[model samples]
Target: MALMKLATTWERFILKDLTKFGRYAKVELTPPSPGELGQVVKGAGGFVKDALTFKWAQATVKEATVNTIVIAEIACWFFIGECIGKGSLVGYQV
Candidate 1:
């Protein structure tokens, strides 16, 4: 009975969270329209310009540390996904 109650509580929490994110996902997952594509290109250009300046250099040590950790997390997740896809950690089995 305790186990069932725990599972029910867990399910409610998950469903609530999923409902919140589903709204965001619906909007974010849609393909960008042509006008949005131009905006994206402009944004990319601005990002490149910022990267070339002292903007990044001005980041505090804490901000730089957080950014490095986030990037490392992304890289680790990509490698994990590749291993999952290949069905082996070391390499694809023949």
Candidate 2:
């Protein structure tokens, strides 16, 4: 009986999480239109300007940690994609 109760709770939690994810996916999974692409370019330019001024050097520890994690995640994904493309974990199968 306890095992069944645990499974029921887990199912409920998973369903709740999936609903939340679906809400975000609807908004975030779409490709940007041309106007949005222009805005993205402008925002990136502003970010580059700040970096040139060493503005990021003054970030709070929490913000710096978050940024570092994001960069690391991107690097990890890049390597994972390369491995998948080459069909090898260590080196290309040449």
Top model number, lDDT: 2
> For each candidate, what TM-score against the reference?
0.58, 0.62
lDDT accuracy of residue 92 in candidate 1: 88
lDDT of each: 0.94, 0.96
Every model: Cα RMSD to truth? 7.7, 8.8
What lDDT score is found at residue 88 in candidate 1? 91
Candidate 1 Cα outliers beyond 4 Å, as residue runs = 1-30
TM-score of 2: 0.62
What are the per-model numbers of colliding residue pairs? Answer: 0, 0
- Where does candidate 1 clash, by residue pair? none
The Cα error of candidate 1 at residue 9, in Å, is 29
